[model samples]
Target: MRQNRHITSNVGDGASGAVAAPPARPADQERTNSPGLALGAKAAGLPIAGLAALLSARIVTDELGLAGYALFALITTLPALLPLGDLGAGAALLDAVAADDGSPRARAHTRGTLISGARMLNLAGAAVAATGLVLAGTGTHTWLLGTAATPSAGACVAVAGVLIGCTLPLGLGASALAAIDRYHVALLLQAAGSAAGFGLVVVAAGLDAHAAVYCAGPLAGQCAAGAAALALAARALGMPMLRTVAASVRPGQQGTRIMHLAGPMTVIYTTSALTYGTDRLVLGHTTSAAAVAVYSAGAQLYRPAAALLSSAALPLWGRYVQRRGAGGGTPRGELARLVAWFAGAALVVGGGLVACGPPVADWMLHGEAPVGPGLMAAFGLLILVHAVNHPVGMWLSDAPGLRFQARGAVAMTAVSLALSVPLAIALGPAGPVLASALAFAVCVAVPCHRRAFRHG
Candidate 1:
């Protein structure tokens, strides 16, 4: 939940550009890449997804109580930590497809990227599942969150691990849709999944199911959505997006092309996870498990809101990539638009949440861990910092851009690690938020904006 939602936006971020003449829009994608269908769907779906997330949080809090809510948060938030869970292979495919020229060779490259990336994701999934089982066997899962170990905790972690494993590759469907300018299509499907997950959680909680079983609701919805999205993309494009599951694609390329981009991306994701995604751990170990829950009260709203804000701007990344490929970079006007939308969105959403979140959280949390304006404001500040960096971050999401961000991210991680513990100790729930925000704003947002201007 503490993941840098801005950076994660790149993985599935980007919308199709205007329907005007341009070399940026792939000849084949013209029909599906229209702005209305892509962005409109997202604009509509964002609310449902956000609502589902909020309702799910209420369900968890009411049924699971404080401990259950904390566990649920950890399980759901773990995916944000494993940034390289896909081995960055899916991103490689996105770049390939986005930069394609509608030639047979371009199609071939996209195919190769998908097949190879899928192979890597499959392996990564197995490894994660095995590691989860090992952790369960060793009885270390319960102690991971700085809490005492117990049999049930171990079992829960193990189950969470296996579920995460299956989800790793399934996420490629969404990634594929993004590459082809159907990001909004994936977003709509994802919203449906979130809504479905909410229904499942409600039913399960009412039936007295284990908290763990219902936590899987969201995961299952996401998995189904991903698979369905990928299948749709594959059928539309005639690409073997699903062939990686059964080794149907020949294994001749050795997958180096796919790894070419994934390697550096994984490094960036690693640094990002270390620098920004460790919020819960910092609180859990440095403060207490209860502190983690307190943070989630505000974070439950902050994370999704921040992510949606970035996502709304994500299509700009794809547009920039395609435009640059055609020797037409983004307009200065486009930059201004991003700055306005994200900043304004952050202001409105953050303020509204601060004003109203407390009452809603009280109802949702049942007073497990108190939520006040201070915590809400800290996350709001983080969202503002995210707004500052999001536009430039879009331009810097390519291979060379990843390399640049990776260097700064390493330094930011150092600063975050040095200060996160102390801040958590001092500020309770808001300390890490400040530390992360400060480090990113100084070390990341500033330099990236400068670089982007120079690139312009």
Candidate 2:
């Protein structure tokens, strides 16, 4: 996030149009281009798929009675296995392909690496799912969350397994697609799959299929989506279903380099996941289901705003990288600008949420749901705190001191784990939210942000 130019000339030399802004550099402002438009539209499309997810959550809560919490918890936790899935290798593949943009060999190499990566991730995910089942069977499911049902408790482990398995490949594909800038196509496939999956759940609910059959439709739909993504990737790059890593390739060197970069990145991703996911799952277990529902609804509404800030920050990240550690004379001025923009936008969004929260909650939870007002306010506070800290985290990502980011994540996770029980005991659901906000601001926001401008 760096910018400095002859604004006077670009603004028309104090003439009638003097205030007009100059266009940005290609690398820095690629978001202004057609490709950027496609990507933004694709990202925007997430809300639609998210809508389907909300619907699915609602139906599951309303009809099947939250049978999939154990499944969701299990699947989400499995992403912690990110280190083994060639998460770093995928990043390397994308960078290599982009560097060799004109080479056919690069495309083939990337495709092969991606396929290998996907397989690795799928295997790891399967192992996690299996572990979950074993835990459930052995009465050790509480490690997953206190909510996991025992095997004989009649929870649908099989259906959950299938759903978790199907989404794994698609998750890999989505990451691969994002790395390569094929965002629009990925978004469409994700949306279609989510919609189809949710529709199936609705139908199953209507027909009153097997007690746990609700998870079946979503699993099947995700599998189809994964297949479609594979086909699209193959067709776009003229590659095939690669079963193995290429014999001629030197994975030890290439994959290692990829992993080195992705190692911290994977941790970064996983820590962020844990920071929030732990709170949700833990809250679900320790508190009422209705409280979980209310918290989730508030989060769901707040997310789009956070996402938009991230979107705005994306181009600036590239710009910051191009500046090569300088913040364009002001030494991190660009980063600060991006952060300010995000903060301003977040405040507006958060305020709007606070204002309309009751009505919004009522609609989301179905009718005048009679949920807690304090819960809604606490949830909004969580999002706003997240907004402030998130950009600091992003700015930290491009710094040479990025390792600090990983440490921050670990700290945040530690705090989340440490405080989850006590806060739940003391203040119930709101306690976790309070703990999360405090941890992020302390462990992440304050220190890294200071570092961003320290030497500039």
Candidate 3:
């Protein structure tokens, strides 16, 4: 199949002095490229996912108490840090597919190679993660995150490795869908996966299952959903699953190009995982699981808000790529409008949470968890910061600005690591949030935005 091409025409006077008609765009292409429709789909999907997540967290915290909740958080966090074994291939796939200026056969070849590479890498990562977890499980009573190195902990880690392995392909599938202008389908699949995971967690909490059982519910849901999504994407793309997998085994230039993008992205994302993941782990080690629980609960407010901002900006990525490919200038007005809207919405949501979080947390935890005013404030601020900065970050995702953004990520990571430990010791649970907010604003947000505009 040939990629869609837009043709242009110039009007000229004929020998008969007649005007020529301008070329028309294909109807299918027009619909597929509609930014408003794409943005609407993403906006619709994210809230449903966010709501499921919030409900799941509330149910788990209520049923399991702080320590159990902390354990749950740790299980989820560890897998997120593992990079799905592809060294950022998921992101690389998205970038590659979006920026591809090649024949359909070439695109298919690239996708296959990336898919194959990601699977192999995931398998390797899973092995390493399982080994590390098994070692940790056997060596000491308390492993990282203050979880007892019981058989269950090891089992949870193993399950997390599996989840990470599964997530990589699903993410690539979503990217493929987006590449084909199926933004709604991609977002829907993601939302459905998150909802499935949430439902499983809720069921486990209701059954009062073992820690490993509870952890397994979400992991299984994620893996299952990812597989389903990948199947759907393959069918939509008109690609045979086995053939694509087979193609992936052979090395190609497309694969090399993907790795080139993935390399820097891997560094940036690793730093991000550390910045977010290490906070709870540090708290668990220095303080207690209960402290981690309180912090996690407070931090939960940030996710939905951030998701909202992200969903709103997600469609802009394709637009940015399209504009850049066409050698057009950045749409400053559109970006500013989005940033302003996101800031307003964030403030409203953050303010509401600040006012109601303490009461809500008290009710949800049944007084087992404390959501103090200070923690709420910090969490609220974090949400606001993330919301405001989201557009800036999205703008920087363009190829020209990615290097600056990566540098910003590194700086932010360093600052977070430096401040998180001491502040956690001094101020307890509120410390990490404070450190993240400060570091993100000073290091990541500031420099990225500055460079993004300069490049723009």
Candidate 4:
């Protein structure tokens, strides 16, 4: 889902979904300068903020021990896997907003329509998640962590579902901010929300709160963050939030078209979720909760580094969309520069992690979660592969290239699933990382890069 913010788009020339070249304009200068600063802010803010959250999580995990930390991880993972929750409407709304060229009144109406539809879809997602949690609680489905389905855990899952449902609409707000080129604000709000959530967890741990109580911290913080973002977006747009919601109930032609773009995106996102998220599910089902803790702990080290790199690349989406709309050709030199930067960053970070990650992991996990050097090295390599591939993937996100990218993603997901099972069983926690790294190289990185370069 974090990747979704930085990738995917529907904005292009109406014909062929490729932007026709446009005459140089003043707005282009603004576009050029603004995105650079925004990207820098995101690159700096996300990792710093993510580190804070990660540290807090480390504290909570240490306090709670392996089983308790696993429960927390399980609660967090549930809402992430519910692909239908937003019904692809947020992505659609982003496209619609980015491409909108209408009178203020007209644009507001379209925004309202899109917002309403997205809200409904998110509500549906929340409902489905809640129902699933209820079923899991009642033993109608397998427990996520293989724990005895206790009444308390069931109650906690229900609460988490409700929180997830509430957060769904907030994603639209963040997307709206991005569409309007308020990327910094969107990123800041996200960072602030994460920090708040981390603080809550840290405080809860300090008080020796139960795992369920600790779980509530993240959900509550997310809700707060979402509300703040929605308020800010509404204020910026000069539209009442309630009126926007009302307007969305009656979608116009544009709203319908947005959904058209969203359909395939939904599938893309679903497969992506399966590809990236299956590791935890596999670990939960096939191994113990403690195994999940160990794997997730090691994996957590990779996330901030990835987030930092991804943030730098994310601004390219807006820039590319603008260029595509102007009918510009691929910026092969710029792409090369980005790829080089990512590759260099990967070498530095991956090398450092390979050298230092074991001690850090041991310290964070407090010996309760054992992360070997081999696991650290594998995780570092995984990060390297993803970093190198991400910019190329983002470059290929325009409509003309989207279908091919989707196919590649599907293939990657299949390979990831196929390999995850054997590797997980054979290698324990590091198995999924190795499997995903291989899948990306074979199914996504190679094909996408080759196609991207050829097209360029």
Candidate 5:
């Protein structure tokens, strides 16, 4: 009788005649999170891409000589500021998209934000390109690097400016793609386009074209590849007509939120640019182009470590946001575990870099350099500090410490100039690292780590 009853229950209910189970969740279909894996893999590729680009630059620089190299960096850097003219839109759009994942609202916002950001960047880039032409026409050629006095040099600057201006819209799209977790596609596009750009530079060099052509090649390729991505994203999101979307969306307050978030970041990035980007420029004033090249080479050797470390933290940060939403406070145990994980990885990776620094430098530079074991050790120590500082500092904005985190960022900025100047003088190229280490140690790590364990 019991078996008969069970069989009847197992049979379809009278209403539908189908035995029903809960719907399969999108997450349940995959044991591991696909997006997370994609992000991690993309993060891993950063080191490889950075290394390849550096090598490509080195090859072109070697072929054209130091004048070619300096001109390339200068031309590239000049246009870089043009792309940044989008203000905080890129960061804002990413935040909005990530916040609204998995809904029609998310789809709408993503499409609208992307279109707005791209258009803004494109216009800005074009304006800058126009300015470059005017400068060239007016004989204000001093800003054109090696072409300062020569007509051909001015022409080269104008061309490079145009290429850079064209790239802004595409670069904006690349950033957007990365934010949407299309990491693999983004990486592929970046690698192929960047490589092609290098080839373009080499070809231009062979023709005895000004080094500006080498600078222009990558920018042109980036813009071209980026257009494809923008199209793909636009289609995927089912974006409405630009006018209709803007009229319907309430992006004003949301835009403000994004600026609030990105403003501090902008400051931090600006300071970092000053700290690091100014290295060659400052050296240029005090030293020879060869010296700048040597410093740049050493700097490049450490670039992989720096980039990978930051990349690895980013997706983990997204997870942090999700977890914070679910809980009242940051789980102390979880925070500790993550911190330890970062520290351990940093130790292993930093030790390896320190061990291999000299050999790697020799290979990259194609000869002996003054970059020695001490410099490597200094680099490793910086990485170690970053490993500890990054997570702890990030966690300050989570859970019970949100206010503290804001205060901490402000404090860090307040003290940055005071902290950085002495360290920069004391350590030369590695001064920023020391300053960063000290900032976290004093402002974030010392306090947060203690508070996290106090409740236990």
Candidate 6:
């Protein structure tokens, strides 16, 4: 049976089938930022921080040339896939701790699970690091990297593997903070880390450091931020990572149950990674590292706007749950309102890309960029499709809804993969974006419209 109540409590994830207990107590509430502050800060922070990271990325691409840019672009994608490293241990850990009711039995169970989960996460990290080692030591570099795969590029890949391994358990610590209602603290640290990492990247690139060092600059920032966050969270939760236990590093029944609950969510993450994150790799293998450079130029423009607009689902989704939960009916016009907001975002972001993209691409890439009207149009449509589709997807909040979302995700993935390679071969950089936009619109968006409007 589905047991973790927080899965539903976190509506942005489209979890359902459980009602949260009332909000935390006053002292408990004081531990985290107020919802207003959290919401408003994200409103301002996401864009600013995204820009900082984008600038750093542009610098990396500019300094690195096509080969370096390809490797850097590929490295940037590692963090997105990090959530999968633990095989659901982190989620299970969050569920176990968040449900704690201050009773001794609950405390013991939470501790054991936390310790075991932490250890599992650590092992998962080491395994990931080993995988990086294998990659570094092997000759199959072209399997994932761009056409400019070099020995140093392999070293950078190993650096990414090590970076991921270190970050995984630290991520667990951040999740622990969230479980205890200290999410804002984690967010603040994250933002600071991004800002700091940008400075570091600029300095290192200016110094003309070696390829591996400069390429791994962002991961270094991540490690520092993660370590700091873990330290703070450990102090708050009184659970030091890897040092607080005599218990065996094995999950008990509770761990198994939480992992089971985490299965569908894992699938959701996997499908998203496959569909949205594989475009660069496809370009690398099917075309050239130069293609990755061109595509990333366009991606840098649209991704921020798409990410910002798509994030609206988090807040809007809660309003739906609150109103519907209170009235025992569908929300009044929330879907329409959200869809309209998304469409507007599409116009501003997508339209701007079409009109101003060429000059901006040239500026960011530090040379004459050859992006055409067709590619810009594809980027616009991709943004519009994702912007509108995200809210509708977030609106589903039940067992069946969850199942439907998973099915849609699977369909979208299949469609994207089926088309991305051949299409990339035919259409160049625009192919994967077009494939994603088409798949999402047809498979996910169409069905979501049926369930969200007419069927309901």
Per-model TM-score versus the true fold: 0.88, 0.74, 0.82, 0.84, 0.71, 0.78
TM-score of model 5 (CA atoms)? 0.71
Q: Write the per-residue lDDT of candidate 4 for residues 142-204, one digit (tens) a residue.
A: 455464233446656766777787677666777666665676677777778777878888888
Clashes of each: 3, 1, 0, 7, 0, 0
Candidate 6 weakest ten by summed lDDT: 7-16
Q: Which of the two, 2 or 3, has more TM-score?
A: 3
Against the reference, the lDDT scores of all candidates come to 0.71, 0.55, 0.63, 0.66, 0.54, 0.66
Q: What is the C-alpha lDDT profile of model 6 across 1-456, one tens digit per residue?
A: 112222112222111112244333443333223334444544566655676666876777667765676677677667664446455555555555655654456655555566656666677778888888898788565576757576677778788888888777677655665555555566666667767767877887889876677656677777777778767765665444434322234443123344453465567667878887888888888997777878887876776556556544443333333334345455427677768877886888788889987677666667745777678889999988877876676566433555677788899999999999999999999999999999989888889878878755
Q: Between prediction 4 and prediction 6, which has the larger TM-score?
A: 4
What is model 3's C-alpha RMSD?
Answer: 7.9
The digit string of per-residue lDDT tens for model 5 on 389-443 reads 5565554433345445445545654454466555555665455445655664566
Best-fitting candidate, scored by lDDT: 1
Q: What's the ranking of the predictions by TM-score, best on top?
A: 1, 4, 3, 6, 2, 5
Judge candidate 5 against the unseen true structure and give its global Cα lDDT, from 0 to 1: 0.54
To one decimal, what is the Cα RMSD in angstroms of model 1 from the true structure? 6.9
lDDT of 1: 0.71
Q: After superposition, how far is residue 68 of candidate 2 from its true place, in Å?
A: 8.0
| lDDT score for residue 114 of model 3 | 56
lDDT of 2 by residue, 367-402 (tens): 523445565566666666666655455445442445
Q: Is candidate 1 or candidate 4 better by lDDT?
A: 1
Q: Order the candidates by lDDT, highest first — what do you get?
A: 1, 4, 6, 3, 2, 5
Question: RMSD in angstroms, all models?
Answer: 6.9, 9.9, 7.9, 6.5, 9.4, 6.6
For candidate 6, give the lDDT of residue 318.
38
Instruction: Report model 4's TM-score to 2 decimal places.
Output: 0.84
| TM-score of candidate 2 against the unseen true structure | 0.74
Q: Which has the better lDDT: candidate 4, or candidate 5?
A: 4
Write down the worst ten-residue block by lDDT for model 2. 6-15
